[model samples]
Target: MSYGLDAHTIKSLKKAQKNEITEHYIYLKLSSFKKNRQNSQILQQIAQDELYHHNALKKFTGTDIKPNIFKIYFYTFISVIFGITFGIKLMERGERNSEKLYGELGQKIEEFKKIANEEDRHEKELVGIIEEERLQFVGSMVLGLNDALVELTGTLAGLTFALKNTRLIALSGLITGIAASLSMSASEYLSARTEQDSSRALKSSIYTGVTYIITVVFLVLPYLLFSNYVLSLAVTIIVAIIIILVFNFYISVAKDLSFGQRFFEMAGISLGVAVISFIIGYLVRLFLGVDI
Candidate 1:
């Protein structure tokens, strides 16, 4: 059930967790100064990563990692929390610290130089930061939710072609939402576990699962409030459009895509999907004639 922990692995994990916790504290502290949606979301995301590192350390060592308990009164928190900003400033200041680290720092860590695989060495350095996995999964899951909100909302909207009863409408929505959420989450978890690449797996699962759930959940909301199937459908479609725009904007801004490119690309893709889903649903209705 347990394997002996390597000293180097232990050291790497400890440093990573310490860095994460310190970063978490900095974000929490930042909350005192500003209250923007972007800042809040970023801070929360960063906090999730820190917690994840702590959890990973626990899994590896079967011991509680208390960042606060490490040192009674030490200020190495600078590297943990401020290292990222420092790196950013270094680049901003137009000085390539890359030379110093690879040339000088690599020489200092002679053991690292002995490792045959340069890639492995880079990977180890990458893993030395604990907050990475957390940032990746959590952020991706949020995107998944956004996708659900847009797509499933569109589904129910298009489904208005079926029947007119509000009960049926709400019932349809309830069915879709619950089913989508459970199915998506389960599928995501399974897929993620099976994946070899941690970051890729997390991103795929979160994006797919969350989007699936959100789309289904919103699809049914109109039925709850309106008796007219057409009206519900119309509102759902409108909501879907709004959601799509928001989702597109989100990806664009987050990824630094050109506004015009993001707009047309997202619009084209979404419209195609919507059209296809609508066609499929309509054909099914015509062939089956609502017997089920």
Candidate 2:
């Protein structure tokens, strides 16, 4: 499989290679950051995952691949808005190619289909991406749910730490979680409904709402598991870290990236959040002399 590749697989393989390179570059760029062992371990895992993806792709396509540094450079130079726009454009291109790839493959002989290993074509893929993007209109509710889930869980954990009563914590968690959910759901629904095609938005929003609620329940379960506030808080953080790591591994497996590389990337993000939040919380407590 070294030189000649089916046009569809070529495109898919190119995209995969380019994405791996981009993640690798991003990881390398963070080399200057002062990281602890846990964070370093995560990055290593993520990088390894990316490498595995790259290698598996090369094995399948048999094409000698090179890093697309120019694309990476362009991405780094772009403003945040333009960067997202660029990503959308790439997604558009990928959707078209994928649709073409899959659609053609659908009509081929079963033997050919087995070789191609895909069923959808370029136009279908393009439409799918478009629909996915547009459908997020209702997904505004989903995103709101996600935000509430993350922030509220973190909030409940922090509050429980500071105020060590289960009934009190339950009341606070209930008020905060419900309020956050309502506010988030309303905002999501309203924003999504504003779109021209609500079908996509509606489906996306519903899926999002369901998924986010599921994630929130999982995040909050530690509190129910342990009666002690401090223990529950600790358990919550551990569970979150485990979930995030597992998610990283699953994503890596899907992309053929090694778990190690994905772990590192996720670990870095988690560390950044934990450090910033801890500093803010610590400073507030110091100034206010609040007891936990």
Instruction: Find the 10 residues in a row with the least total lDDT in model 2.
Output: 79-88
- Tell how far residue 138 is off in model 1, in angstroms: 7.1
- What are the TM-scores, per candidate, against the unseen true structure? 0.45, 0.44
TM-score, structure 2 vs. true: 0.44
Q: Which parts of model 2 have CA positions greater than 4 angstroms off? A: 1-146, 245-292
Report the CA-based lDDT of candidate 1 relative to the real structure. 0.52
| Candidate 1 Cα outliers beyond 4 Å, as residue runs | 1-135, 142-154, 196-211, 283-292
* lDDT tens digits, residue span 97-216, model 2: 434443454464343343234223322332332222323333353354336445755566556645566556666766676566655555555666787357755565555555455556
Candidate 2 displacement at residue 175 in angstroms? 2.5
- Please give the CA lDDT of all the candidate structures: 0.52, 0.52
Tens digits of per-residue lDDT for model 1, 1-292: 2335467655654554554455455445543333455544654555564465456445655666555533312322432443333222222122122222223324544522332233233223333332333234544554465456545554654565655466775787677767776677667766676864766765666666656666666657777888887787777767666766765554443333455665666556666666676677777788888833
lDDT of 2 at 177: 67
